[model samples]
Every structure is written in C-alpha cells, then in structure tokens.
Target: MGEERRGISRRGLIGGGAALGVGAAAVGFGAGRATAVETERAGAAAAYSLYGAHQPGIVTPVQDRLHFATFDVTTDSRAALVDMLRAWTDAAARMMHGDGAGPSGPTSGDYDAPPDDTGEAIDLPPSRLTLTFGFGASLFDDRFGLSGKRPAALDPLPHFPGDNLRPERSEGDLCVQACADDPQVAVHAIRNLARIGFGTVGMRWSQLGFGKTSTTTRDEATPRNLFGFKDGTMNVKSDDRDALADHVWVGEDADQPWMAGGSYLVARRITMTIETWDRQSLREQERVVGRTKSEGAPLSGGVERDQPDFERAGREGKPLVDPAAHVRIAHPDHNGGVQMLRRGYNFVDGSSDIGRMDAGLFFLAYVVDPATHFVPVQMRLATLDDMQEYVQHTGSGLFAIPPGVRRGEYVGQGLFSA
Candidate 1:
C-alpha cells in the first residue's frame, strides 16, 4: 500500500467521496495537487492484512492500545462451537478490512431486525487493527471430543514461587487479542466477536491496556514498562525472519501438525506496588532494574544498545550488574539463550479496596513452546529477581494460537477437518 493509502481519514471512509479516492493518485505531485479533504483521507486508512502464514497480531507492529478477552465454552455441542468459530472468523476478517462486522453493516432499512454491527466504529479507520484468536488447554477437554487432539505443549503452566493468582482472572477456554491504534476500533472488534458467539461462549475476564511496553520491530524505539524502565532491549525484532522462525513460530514437526506456523501465547497480569517503589531511592531503583534511568544503559557501562558486561567489577569488587537484578535474572545469557517475543502493555485499573492504585504491566509473550522457552526463564526470575518484591503476578493464561486462516476457511479449520 502507498503512504497515501495509509492516511485515509475516518470521515472519508464513512462518507464515500471522490476527493478521498482521488487523493491516492496525487503522490509525487507539487503544491496544491491534492485537496485538504484528500490529504485527511489518505492519512486515516492504515490497515494490516488478516490472511497470512501466521496471525497478524503476533509479529505485526505493536499497536498503542489493546483489548484482550478470554471466554469459556458454554455449549457442549462440537458443531455449535465450530459454527461459532466460523462466524467469528468471518466477522474478524471483515472488521480488519475496515468493513462492518456483518452483511447489514452499521445500518439497514429493515427496522424490525437488529443491526449486525455494533455501530460504535462506523466512521473509524481500521487503524492497523489485528485480531488474534487462540485455544486454551481447557478447550481440549472431553466436552468437544478434542481430548486426543490437544497439543502436548498446551499443558497448564506450573505455579511459580511468587504468584498471587486469582482464580476468577486466570484461565479460560479461548482468548481473543485485539490491538489497534484507535482504542475504539480494538474494543469494537472484541465486543462484536463476543456478540457473535453470544450463546456458545461467555466472557471469563478481560483487560484493557494502553501505552505499549515493548517494540517488536527494529525501526521503532523501545518503550518503557510501568516501572519506568526500558523493556525488551534485546527482544527478537520482526525483521529478523530467522529469529522469528526459531524462537516464535512452531515447526511442522511440532506436537501437532495443525499448529505448524502457529505459536504459544503466555499472558501474565503483573500488579506493581507503585507506592513502595516510589519511596525507594533513585540508586536503589536503578539497582533493582539494573539500568541507568536516564539512558536505560546497563550498570556495567556502555550505550543503551551495547551488550551488558555481566563480569565487570564495581567499587567494592562486586559485579556491576547485581546477580539479583531484574535484567540479570531475565537475561537470555543467564537462561539458555532462549527468548520469546514480548508484546506487553502498561495498565492502570482505578484502585484497590484500600485505595492504592491497581496498576502494572500486562505481560504477553509469543514463543515456539512455553515448556522450554517461558517456564525455565520465569522460574529463575521468580526466585532470584529483586524486582519481584515490588510486583505480584495476579492472573495468568496460556493458549495455543493456531496458524492463520485462508480467505474461505475459518480459524482452527485444520482441527475440525478429517
């Protein structure tokens, strides 16, 4: 798509006009070649393709906003569940293309029947919206005759040392991750998908996130987490195709063939103790995160992009980067060089019962296998990281994100086929 095509305005999309369509042809022209209306239209139409080898949301550029929801399968009938997946797939495809969720769209002359779309995003652009769906381990229960089809790698995550998990917000049978530059666009996608699966599935828990916490591509600058520390400095960028294939995408020889190009998603709701962290000295804070607050550089010395010198010595002959520092414990070198793609967001939910702010990072990671990639890494952090004292893991989930859908096929079609 041209730069002009990505700039189409919401008004231009809702009210079809020649000015908006003509703007795309004005590229490389001099002054006054395109009207102001045309310019607005060209700027507002950014979108991501929904059909691909893998889901768009996994490796797509991280969006500014997120609406992630998990659902429980309410019906025991396999046909009903399959039908709902198909319906959801269709609606997702339409919504991602900047179209309404259903055939009738935002409006219809037939007043007696309810409109198919929720009408909240009628005039908005797609904003690079991407809706990713995944199946939880619980979905493979005998309820849908999928007991034997469950990928062995989809097993439930083992409980860690510092987890204060709440049962209500933990796991679900399915998950939908909607991300977009426009908050309304992301919310609308999830709301409509839930509406489409009304009778067959019920929402378990959901999270709304803002201010992305990491960068998935090399061109973008790294973002900070709620703790005011730059996160994912060594993250596997989407541009590194080889790294993505080895660390994120599942191979055909995986436990299940249906998950060939798919990946595993691990979501953790980590609540930060902002009050306690704020009271600490700047030096203490830097020690905990193991990076300079101003430059986000390693304590061992060097620029932000330089590799940390873990063996460097300090004033008292102690390691410059403490062994218990958050960065040190979570570093790939400390672990087996195993890394996952981190696409998280900073969240601030009003307050707790005692009046303290309920805010932290909603950690989301995509990996080839959680068993080898996520489990051991988290295990080390849970026991050794000093940052754990100021944060608590309150909710968690794991899902097997299936491969992308074709034009005519539905999500998870491979599992249902003979």
Candidate 2:
C-alpha cells in the first residue's frame, strides 16, 4: 500500500529539535503510559476524557469516532478572558512549510512544546486540533465580539432532508472549541487552552447529537430508530476526511503559520420534533421507512448488508426504502450513502401551554471537508428521506475557528492573519 490512510503525510512534516520541549503539541494518548512533557503552563491537574467510537479511528482496535461535549466559562473581565485565551494558544512558534528541519523555535510561554522523534516541537497537525469560536446570540450587540453578519463560509448547510432548521445571523461572545479523540489527547489540548487565563471553563450542558431515541450504535444493523427503518442512514464515516475537507476544513498551504493545523469554523442549530414522530403507528411508520417497523429489517429482508428488497413494497422494482420514504428519500440508489458527522445535544428553549415545553436536539457538525461529506448527504435528504415528516432544522449559523497558537499567543492570531 502506498501509505496507511491514517499516517500523517511527511511532505510538510518538519522534524528534529529539542527533546525537552513541553506543551508542544497534544499527544495521541489512547491508553496508559503518559507521553507528558512538564512545563510551567497550566501547572498540573487531573484530567478525564469520554472517548467513544462513532466512526473508525487511530485508537486501538481503530474505529471512526470523536469525543463530543460542550462547555463554557465566564471571565472575571472580558479583557482578562481574551488575554488568557491568547496566551494559552501562542506558546510556541508553529512550523512554517519552508522550514528545512523541524526544530524547537524559541520558547515563548509558560509551557514547553512536546517533542517528536526529531526533538522538534511541532504545531498540532491538521484535523489533529480544531477550534470553532461561536458567539452567544446576545454578545454580538456589544463592541467586544464579532458584529452583525458572520463571514460567508462560517454557516451551516442542511445536514438532513426536509429543512426546518436554518441559520440566523448576529454576533456574540465566542465559544472556545477544540477536538482530539484520545481522552489524553483531548485533555492535553484542553489543559493548554486553560494555561492562558481562559482556563476557568464550565459546561452549561453538552452531549453527542442524534435523535432522542436509539443510542445510535454500530452493533445494530438497522442503525435506524425503534421504528425499524434505517435512520442516520446517511452520515459520514471514518474515510470521509477528504470528502468533507473543502466544506469543513481550512486548507491553507504550509506557508500559513497554522497550515498543518485546522482553521476554526462552526455549524450550529436547533433541531426539533420527536413528539410528532411518536404519534405514528408501527404499520404506518413502516411505510415511512419503507421497511417493516418491527425488526428494522429491510422491507424486502435478508439481513442489512444484503440489498434490501425494495421491489416488494412499490409497483416498480424499487427497494422498500420507498422513493418517498425517509430512507428511500435519503438513500435512493441503495448503494449511495449520505455523508455527515452528527454530534448534537438535547436542550430546552422554553415552554408553551398545557405545561408543555420547547426542547429538542441542539445540533452541530464541524466539516473540514464539506463538498463530498456534508453537502451530498443533505441534498439527498432534501430530495427523498422519509424521516423529514416529523423533524425540521430550525436555527443555525457558521463561524471560522482559528488554529491553536503556541501557549502564549492569543486565539485571534490566525483570524487576523486570515
């Protein structure tokens, strides 16, 4: 094989610097044996991670998945918050594309960069670390945060068919986001973030997004909800990095300070409607998924991977995943798969009469490559998915996330340069 898909490309990979660098880049710590480099930054504290495989991955037993959660912190003062965020990120000088050898540049912050075999402290590799800065809707009105409309690309596109959630624009104080699946990897990245004054973090609430029902695990062949039809039948798998790159990633050349690192961005929205779905019956509901509602087997049957028997349900020779059924609408060809990485949470917006309340999945997906992975999935649903009848995407927006700076740097460094 030319190279393992998971291996980092060496084209721009610089090597050889100092073995003692601390806080260099986050480590891909999957289990025990800490690959830690001590430093003055963020002192020391116990850290924990909740890593699970939703997709395939580099973690042992290799599966594609990501750690999903949301958190926040109130700064003693806005100025103090900004300064803290900046210093945490800019601790090291990121590797430029043209550098002959990857070596530790001058130490600039409270922590030292971690060293690769070359002893060089490198920047977080692309997709290795991602930051998305989203503002609270109210924060935009003030002078401190992004004002008015967001940039063109920092917006959410439809992830599922039958569009209900759409984006609305207004600036707000930003949410500091980061990603790395290994609990240690995630914790390391997070600790570096706190080293700057921005460390006082709190999660108002957060969870992986999908529907309220079904945990959405791979163990089940149906992959749909209790209704038995294929659900989330259209989603991104581990191999989709290239497919979503254009839409979700900030692909800068190595020349940019953070080239190998990802550019920060956002896609956020409020997803609603599980109650309407509950009212349907097993038989009627089966019609929507184009399969039997009891076993979650294809309408035609014969295990999940085998071609589902669509011909039995309709007049023409289509699989039971009816052209109009959510699955049929979402996966018309049977062979085609929709692409989207679903990481969302459930929340309460407010209430209505009868003691009823407004609450549902608050959805978000960061795309480094959108054209292939994100768009096609949404396009298919807009045209065919049966699942659309009960749900609607409600409110949404996009934001560009800046890359991590060496510990002492501010979060806005890349944004200003971009």
Candidate 3:
C-alpha cells in the first residue's frame, strides 16, 4: 500500500530532481524549461486509497460531482453474478488508481481487439475517484440463493407523507456510487463499469449530481442545497472518529458479521417545488428552515456554529425557533441522539412540460442502521416539518454496503465465503 501507485506521470519521471540534473548536464536548459517543469509538478494531485476497513466513498472527502447508478441482475446463474462482481472489483481498483479498466488499456496497439478502457480519462488525474457498491433489498429475494444471508436491517423504506414515488426510478438490485472532483472522471468510471457488466447486469436507474450539498470536514465551507440553505452544519466529519464509530460504522457483533465495517445507504430524490418556494417571503422561508439565510445561524441564534437554543422565546414568549421548523424537527437532540453522515448533491434533470425545473437534492446518508437512525428522523420530518409542502420525495432506495476488500479480494467476497 505505498499510495497504490496511481500511474506515474511523464512529468514525475522526467522533471524530478535526478531527471532534471541529468537533463541539465546533457543539454543546458533555460527559464522556459524550468517553468514548464514547475507547471507539471503543480498539476492536480488527487488520489484515495482503494482498499481499507470500509469503503472509500462513504467517509472519504466529499467530491464535487457524482454519477450514481443502480443495476438489476439479469442473469439467473449465481456463478455469473459472482464472476461479474469479481470483474467489477478489479476494474474499480484500477480506475481508482488512475489506470484503465482492464489489463490492456485504451492504447493497447491491437486494432483488431476492442480497447478495454473508453479513452475519455486517458490523460486525466484520478481526481480522488471512489467507486462504492451496495446490495439492494431485491438482491436477496431468493435470487442467486442469497436469501439467507440478507441482513435484518436491510428492510425496505416506508412511504413518507409527501411522497410521489416513481417505481422506475426508485429501486434496483445493485447500486454503484461513483464520486470524483471532476464530472468527466466520475462519468468515465460508471461507463466502463456498465460496459463490463453487460449481459450480466443492466442499469435500472441513474442520476447525475453536481455541486455537493454538504461538507464532511471542518476545513470545507458548508455547502448549500437546492433550497439555498447551508446543509450538514452538524454532520459527522472524517475527523470525528468517535461519532463515525458510534453513528456510521457497523458494529463487530451486528446482525451480519460480514457487514461489520459496512454501513447502510439510503438514497432519496427529492423534487423541489421551485416556483412555489420562489414566491414565499424571506421571513416565511427563514421561519420554515429555522435559520438565517445569510449566516445560517439558528433563529434562537448567536452564530452559525452556536448550538440552537430551542427553548428560547422571542416575541410575547413565543418559541424563537418555530415548532414545525425543518431544523427543529431534524435535530439530533430531538431524535434520541441519532445522526447520519449526509453527503448529498443538488441535481437538475431538465424541465417539465410547464417549464418548471425538475430538480432537487439527491440525498445520500450512511448510518449504522436505518431502522434507528434514518427511519425515525425521516418519519418525523415527513409529518411535522413545514418544508414538506415545498418538496416531494419522488425516488427512494436502501442498500447494504459491504465491508471493503483486501488487495487480492473482490467487493463482497466475505458474504460468498462459506
């Protein structure tokens, strides 16, 4: 694991100290050459470890772009599915390391044979690419004889109050979450994986997201969602090791041992009523969200990071934070101390017939158990939050993300091992 060897660049080999010394000795170079050398060294440095106790994308630094896809297992053969998983695992490792999908890359020089990689990301850096896989509830439905191995916590999500779900976009048998700083790099990873999965698994649904809606580190400025509110202000950051272990990571003695280091993933496509929200007054909007739009501070407020004083009163002894406010209902203190790692992204999928934007947040959350962490919190939000009137939950999915693989192993090998 010496940084996984994400392909050495030509600049790294030809412009380093030793290489520069040799070049200067052979042919004395000038200022322009020196500038070019420095420029090459200053190029993007983005790479993440592909092998670890848990998957990289969940807790890894939140990338700016996302390409999320879900697929159905078309082949009935268990062996065929396993084989495809192996292929996908290998391809993911190579892609994360900035290499091509297969052994022979795009420039294999064999014109007669098809190229393994699609050639889009040939000269691009890794961009901190992460490919995370998960198993949906349907995957355990007597198909591939995996019914017995399904985790008890992998139950399907219940319908919420303002849900207008589309069956076609809601669920799938398997899911692949690809995130990267560059949009093209994220797309390249998914395209190559889908190409490799042909004949075995076919994509059921997909979503493209840009401008991350949350921040997972203290150094990162809190990002805004479609509603223009600072999102994930109290999120479980990578530095919060204790919070991650307690709220995000699965325990050692869990329902399924194979999923010890893994966590449950919940994906929701919330469509915003943009026209309606646009007409609302600033006071009404702030009251609904329970925070100041400018500073993102709680209405009971001091500053952005100040703990919300829920009991504080304002005019005529009225509660300062609205009882039905989004922040009030979704606060961890009110939800039995339950918190999720939110890494969502804002998305816009064109427009409807009336020209209203078909857009909202593609919410992604990782929790130790959705039953305890997500279900209760969402249940409260769906019923009590005043913000529900301005948004609709159009798509939903739940998956069991397995533990990460070792260098020589596949993604879900532990489950397959007898």
Candidate 4:
C-alpha cells in the first residue's frame, strides 16, 4: 500500500506498468519448483483477449468463481483517477494472460521495496481470468467534472417492495468484476488492482462467490441456486446475437454516445433465509419456482429447456405454473419481452448473527437499459413471485459498463474524452 515510498514517481510507475503489460502479453514461464509442488492443480489456463467489442466478463462463458469489488474515488484530481485506471487496465491485460501484475515478476521485484505483484497467483494459470470495469452513478459527480457525461440510463435504481439494502454493501464510484475458473486467480486480480489504486481509490465493498448460478453458454448444464431450483435456464446466451443486441448491448442509438457498444450492470446481493427455506416441503419448493425439483421442467410438463406454458391448467382448473411463481412472474413474456444476460454465482459467507447460514445468490445481470430490462421484471418478482419470501435483496449497485478498450487506450477513454 505504501506505493509512494517505493522510490519511484507515481507517473513513472504507471508508465512502466503499461509498457511492461504490453510486453508481457506474449511472455511465458518455464516449469519451476512451484509447478512441481503444485502439480495437482490445473494444467494450462485458457486466456481471453482483454480488447474486443465488449468487455470479456459480461458475455464470456460464466466462470466457476467471482471476486467482484466496488470502489470509491478518494482523490479529487481527474489526472490521478485517470492514471490509476490506466495502471489498472495495464495490470489487468497482463494478468488475464496469466502473467505477473508487473513484468519484473512478483518475487523478482526490488527486494528493498514491496513487490509489484501480490505473488499469490504466481504459480497459477490464467484460468480464463477477466477483469471487467464500470462506472457507478456516483462517479459522474462534479469531482472529476464528469456530470454532463452521465448517461441517463445510469440513473439510480428505484427501491422495490421489500428491499433491506445495507448502505455499506451498496453503491460505489466504480466497480471491477474479476472472474476465473480458479478462485485464487480471481482473488489475486482484485487484490493487485486494489494495491495498484492505493491512494486514488478505496474499495467500498467486495463479494467472493463460488459455484456459478447461471450459464452464459448453452452447452454447460444449467446450475441450481441455493434454493435448489435451476436458475437462469432460459438465460440469454453468448451465441444469441439477436438477444444480445436487443437486450444487452447499448448501440449507437444510446442517449450518451460514449456509452455505445457498452451495457448497464445491475448487481443484487440476495440473502436467502436458508433454514426457513430448507424447511419448506418439496411440493412447496416446486410450486414457488414453477419447475419440477428433479429435472427443472416447467410445472406444465416438459424438459428443462421447455418454455413455461402459462395458460396450462391443473386438475383444479388452476394454472399449472402458479400465477405468482418466480418463473411466471419474471419471464420475458410477462416483463414486456425483456430479458437479461445473467451471470450470477452462489456464495456462503459463513454464518449469520443468529447462527444461520449467511449464504445466497450474488445476482449479476447485464442489460442494455435497466429501465426496460431489469426494473419492471424485478418489480413484478418482488411483489408477486413466491420466491420473494425466502430471499431478501440486501445489497444493490447499478453501473455503466464502458466499451472494450484498444491497445494504448485505457478503459473508459471515451467517457473522459467525450
């Protein structure tokens, strides 16, 4: 954290970081003692390009782990903030390729000073690591003279029926979503970034997630949530270009030109009442989810991928998929044909105050506009979905994701220059 005492000017450090990041892209290390010691781990890691039409984490195949962090801008200087972002982007590009945070390597850095890289991920593969960044509503404030550049779609999310959101766990000026197959890889990405941002930014809150709750690729089997029902079975997939265009990516028509090709992100930390939910009968659970407990078929009868037939009736002439069921209430058909590209993960943060499991879904979704794709669907779910009783929206954030960056350009370059 004492980056200043490292006997180097901050600007020089940032410049060197960027130069080393670019050069490290094609660098590879030979098998060493660490690899021999950790031979049990995964072999080679799959690396994704850090530069593209859109950020990697949003539509990239959902990873097994996530380390999502939101940060507050501590410095009022726009130059300082920009420099920190450039440093972050450089480090992220290098790390995604499984390289050290700095070219000097973690342990090889100057012995007299703290290491440039954290060294925890030294022996790890990239594991398809991705670092996606975004700007929260608060980041558009007068501090950096960015008020006019604020996108209308970045407006604060409205409160829903039963939200018990905690202030400490809520919004921030910026967010960085790191995901990788290895938990250590994801954790190391955030830790190094936080270290790099030292004085310019302060981490407001962070969430560690394991066991992905949604699938962005159709080939992977659908995953179940803590409630034991298939979550995001009908999620928008990376191959569905039409759906991504219609519901996820911001296009040229966006009110803010700088946001074109970008997307809006909504994160909800839903805490489930694990004990109470576990007590519910099998039939009750099935009814709440509108899907069979075993195969995840719609209550109306079909395989996991079968669309829910809302009009189907049961023996008593009542709808087979309950009118208030989560699947029914939050379906695209019911939400003005809107859908979200969800990439959430399950998390168990030890125990609660009363000794119950402190676990739930860390719900993350990408949409073109939350106004059309998220708010209304969530409103219906909050008010009518039977699953509402078992889960509480405890933490929330809305961020404006910038388009992918080009080499020599930092993330969010458009917003600052526009």
lDDT of 1 by residue, 65-87 (tens): 99999999999999999999999
Positional deviation of residue 147's Cα in model 2 after best superposition, in angstroms: 11
**lDDT of residue 276 for candidate 4:** 96
Q: Estimate TM-scores for all models.
A: 0.91, 0.49, 0.90, 0.90
Tell me model 1's lDDT, rounded to 2 decimals: 0.84
Candidate 3 local lDDT, 180-276, one digit each (tens): 9889889999999999999999999999999898788899788888778898888888778788889998989987888998899999999998789
Best by lDDT: 4
Worst 10 residues of 3 by lDDT: 31-40
Q: After superposition, how far is residue 226 of candidate 3 from its true place, in Å?
A: 1.5
Write down the TM-score for model 1: 0.91
Better of 2 and 4 by lDDT: 4
**Order of all candidates by lDDT, from best down to worst?**
4, 1, 3, 2
Position 346, candidate 3: lDDT: 93
Question: Which stretches of candidate 4 lie above 4 Å from their native place?
Answer: 1-44
**What lDDT tens digits, residue by residue, belong to model 2 across residues 133-166?**
3434333334444343333344444455455543
Each prediction's total of clashing residue pairs, residues at least 3 apart in sequence or on different chains, is: 9, 69, 0, 0
Tens digit of lDDT per residue, candidate 4, span 237-322?
88788898899999998888989989999999999997998999999999999999889999999899999999999999999999
Report how far off residue 360 is in candidate 1 (Å).
Answer: 0.8
Model 3 bad stretches (over 4 Å): 1-43
For candidate 3, give the lDDT. 0.83
Residue pairs with backbone atoms closer than 3 Å in model 1 (clashes): 7-42, 7-43, 7-44, 8-41, 8-42, 8-43, 8-44, 8-45, 9-41
